[model samples]
Target: MTTDHRTHARVAVVTGGSRGIGRAVCERLAQNGLAVVVNYARDAAAAKETVATITAAGGRAVSVQADVADENAVTALFDRAEQEFGGVDVVVNAAGRLALSPIADLDLEVLDAVLRTNLRGTFVVAQRAARRLRAGGSFVAFSTSVVATRFPAYGAYVASKGAIESITLILARELRGRDITVNTVAPGPTATDLFLDGKGPEQIEQLAKAPPLERLGTPQDIARVVAFLTSSEGHWINGQILRANGGMV
Candidate 1:
């Protein structure tokens, strides 16, 4: 769906774009006039639906399936974007896995699965983006506000996102002179399935209140920040972990 009509608009490849924050980011980027490549791991139906919604609104979009941890797959993801659109200007690695468990009783297998997706997947996508993104492009990865809050039972999840934050700056510095921006969006208590799953109303209420804004961050809230980061206006802001948690930190 490279029919963006607007020649000045850029292109974006978003992993996990089928659902949740990724989906929201795709729509927002489209509204900002960027042609979107919606990448999904397994949910082809959802991915197609996302593409349909965007295209229905006169936005250019296409769906592609790729496991974020697979280097070749992500490489092909970028290839698909370039094949559809002219070039890639923005890459958002919103695909992540979260498992909350106290370290004392941590399951090694669970840890491995979480890290495999959240860590290795991020790196694979970033590696491809590093190679494929055009000059002045930006990459935004996902992290968690819990990295600062240090909540219990979040050891595994926080550890993975923590590693993401650590690598983001190095990647940014490494991309010097390329004019690419690499940053992480560390959201806090976002109102998405990933955050709400397995949590009760009471827990949800507590988290909502934890933020000074007194509400769980909507997918759109975080989406807008990502939209800005990928835009030319945000090019000056590079190599930073933006806590889009509504003051949860």
Candidate 2:
């Protein structure tokens, strides 16, 4: 899946590139002629596999370990990206965790995890990208479509992503004079492990039928959009929450 005649080869850092949407982003960016650094928090083997995929396909990439929520680790991750790939050109904050619990039974620990990983983690990564990215670069943040649909057990998770959407506005303003753009991608319920875990057959059927597009989104679907948002063609698209949720909700 090599891209055609990429004018400028840039360096991109994709957090949580070990699996799901993150892996898809890494593969797409690598194919688009960027030397990507695939950052993973815990899945070392999966991270390496993404790297291998890129390398095997004749693209340049590396697997780096970092918890995007941890400031120190994130700083180190950015530093390493600069050291290894020259400088960071794009940053995609795709790493996230989802916990389902009703508000009454919502574990405080689960709430903390959700906030730390999705909101705070995205902030840390986006801030670094804003400060470190070169002119003409871009920063993309991930938010879930659940924020729009507002399912029952997804309250906390949606809240965290909602916070991401809020922060994206601020970050875009902060990138003012620089040619860099900041935006959020709100994906509809996709068929990722994080999304379809406990759904029974009936629930799955209902969900698949609910969306106007009549199917769950694939990683490749979201990945292609992320690639576009980070590309030169997306320069004018800033401070917008682009929803890629198959017209759902």
* Each model's lDDT: 0.92, 0.90
Q: TM-score for all predictions?
A: 0.96, 0.96
Per-residue lDDT of candidate 1, residues 128-226 (tens digit):
999988887899999999999999999999989999999999999999999899999999999999999999999999999999989999999999999
Predicted candidate 2 versus true structure: per-residue lDDT over 15-83, tens digit per residue: 999999999999999988899999999989999999999999999998999999898999999999988
Which candidate's lDDT is highest? 1
TM-score of 2: 0.96
In the predicted model 2, the residue pairs found to clash are: none
